[model samples]
Target: MKLLLLKTLLQRRARDEGFTLPMVIALGFVMILLGMTNIVKSSEENLNAITQNSSSDALAVAEVGITKYRELLNQNRILTIYNDDQWNTNANVTGQACNDLTTTPTGWEDGGTATAPNDTTKWWELREDTDGDGTDELIGEYRLVSYQYDIDDDDFDSSTPPTNNNGQFSPSDDNANTTDDFTFNDVTYDPLGVIGTSNSPEGYNPTGILTVQGRSTDGSEAQIKVEIPLRINQNDLENLDPALWIGSTDTTYLANLNGNLGSLTVTDGNVVIIDAASAGSSGCSDPADGASYTVISDAREVPSISSIASKRTEAVNAGINNSIPVTSPAVLGKTDDDPYVTPPSGATFDEDIHCANISDCRYYYDLSATDITAVTETDGIAKVTLYVDGNLNINQDLGSNVSSSYLEIYVTNSGSITIDSDSTNTINALIHAPESQLTVNGTGTVKINGSVWVDKFVNNATVEIEPDTTRISSLNTAPSYKLYSTATARTPRPLTGSPTNWVREEVQ
Candidate 1:
């Protein structure tokens, strides 16, 4: 009829374009191989997140060159690690870079090394903001490869690194006969494998394995290494000694002649009355019932059996930061803006005890040796142990005053040992308070040159402190318990032990 309806509309448009152009070229070739595997997995996850963020910033720049070379060799490893011969590699072929006086300074060395620091020293740069955003971020730099193992067996041989660098490090070559100095019990330890030594400000060193390197300015050079091993401490509280003050409890008049065990308070006329007091080799006639003071506890009743006890539980566990744990009594508050220098207003008891120059002082207490700034100091201790757990009132007024030089008063107090001085005082030192009760109330006359071991002994007043074996063997050499107990004494980790005390060895 009109050509049979145009052949059925061209056969229904060829079955509706059967498979349009090969299914649009096979779905555009599988979407271009899934967009090239997501662009090669986002370019290998941005090159493995930029090689794990430049290998965690080259190991935090090798732990900031092993903590600034263990704080520039433990703050003065005997004048900069015994004169650091510069660990070879031609010393400093111009490792130049890092001056910073404030031209915009405080951390960002060019990772210097082409060498160039003939003079003008002091350099440290490491910039890092970490997004807190004050503006820092430089990431990657370190130094101190002055490696000096000369061969102690830690390995660094990188094609022979030492080169016989002779600057100084002799303990008589390691003790061929002397020089090394060790001394166990009496406490010495000079050079001998070090970790302890201090005449006060003198120095010492011994654990320094070596190796510091670090890199990664970002080109992906990324490197790192550490190996450290440092530590230090050993002052045995100067020397330690109270020689003799044996006042087991007798109360004033002069503690039974000098030696003590008590049983003498003769009071017919208030007498210790040395009526012609001259008798040696056991002579000196005088009625019995002696003791003015001086009796070192235990006649046999033994409180805790002491020859002279009470190290205050081994100096409160070797944490003795020059202690002052009064517990109450307000712990002796000061505040006048307290920079120290406020104790003498009536002075019953208050000793700041750290007077570098508290108005030109003569040291009434141990000067700073440790306790370093005492984080928050509540009377911090360790200038060699002053542990006074509590009660040690020594009311002062001593106007005669006499301490020619050399003075040490450890006073391991726990309670009671009062001496209300009125004037004319003389306590040369070595007064070990075995565990309390030994009062000597005021009106003053006190003169105890050296030695005192108390427990229960009251000497009404008028002074004491007598046994002086050549000045208590030149003032004890620190032994009889440097902190013995609480599991084998401590307080000399030397330098790198641990918060809980570690490091007899740590290779990595």
Candidate 2:
């Protein structure tokens, strides 16, 4: 009965041990799978790190290489010439036998033996004759033996050959057939020469800047570049002080002016003052409004009588004014028969005279006249004093045949000079100093074909033109900048202490 109880205890112990075996196996399998996964992940991370490091190194090397190439191109010497002839025949081989032996040997037999007999007195002569004559004859003669020894066989088999008199393989011949026929076309041989290509990367433009120490074409050691930008602004225009922009809105004046009416000051007043003539009627007057004027102010100031008279004279002389009729010579001579009546010489006196021809009359100078007519010179200088009772007219023939001097016209103490021209008639005047302020006052028009350089001030000047037109242009344009690149070489040296690598960098 005790033995049976011990047997039941043993059976229960076996059942527990069965579950323990499966648990230990499962734990071992999980440990193995976890270890393998860790190993694979660690390997992948290591590989990725190595790849990143390699890419960085490669990028640096490529950049350096490109820079080095640029420097090489920029250098003075760039190309080297090994051979320049179209058909260079210079052989680069040495220790080459000239011909084949054994087959058609003059002194060599088919067997590995010499033709000279033993103990022969002419052995030296035979050897020499065989070496010289046999080589010449064998190479010069044509044969049809087999592809191995045949020079005429287009499809010569080089794999199989006879033991003797077989054609030997020559590296020089192979090089000649493969590489020696190279011909350079349109090649420029320059040392330190620059070359360009259109294969640049997008948005990556290369430019070179060279700071040379030697003298330049201007005989100065200066900084020169292929590219430069130029800018022009309002400051530059201000410095030049062109006449077109002078004193219109940029000038200041005195604040006050005293007058006879209780010493009238010009403070905050728009009226200007006109001084009276202390002498005679030689002074100017306001326009007739049927009122007897004692003194005149800026508000009553009017165009001078002299200016109007000058313009009238100019129009009459130019044959544009028909109101003033010119009488015939015979009629004028009859009226001036007395010759010494001496008409009253006043400011408004109209003197009538007779001339045999228009050239016989002298230039009239009356400051109160409407117009005066004159001619100019071919040499661009017109010198004429115009005293206008109305308007002034420059009716001068401008040429060397008419006038040999410059055209200089003066509007002397008169009204404005009006430059008028028809399609067939044109007037060019170079006005100089005037007694009063000169004005280009006219309802009629004037045009200048050439540039006018004004060295003096023009009061109340007006330049009328068609709307929206270009006023000026550059007579000579300036140059612009450009960019270029070149390549150069650096000295070859070891990259560290090792002889395997080299050091390359762009110096400039």
How many residue pairs clash in all the candidates, one count each? 51, 61
Cα RMSD of all models vs. native, in order, equals 25.2, 39.6
lDDT minimum window of 10 residues, candidate 2:
479-488
Candidate number with greatest lDDT = 1
Residues 1-508, model 2: lDDT tens digits: 9677546444646447766556658867999999999999999999988766654443333333223222322220100011111001222210111110102223222234332111111111111233654552211111111111121122122355422211121111101112222111112223233333222212111112111111112222211112111111112211221111111111111111112122111111112122211111122222122121122221111111122112223234342231211222111111111111233456332234343432222222223443544433232221122233444444323321222111223344433444433322333323422233333333333332211212122322223211111211111111100000000111111011111112232221
For candidate 1, give the lDDT of residue 19.
Answer: 55
Model 2 whole-model lDDT (C-alpha atoms): 0.24
Off by over 4 Å in 2: 1-362, 367-385, 389-409, 418-425, 433-508
- Residue-wise C-alpha lDDT for candidate 1, range 402-439, written one tens digit per residue: 22112233334345557666776555444455556667
Task: Report the number of backbone clashes for model 1.
Answer: 51
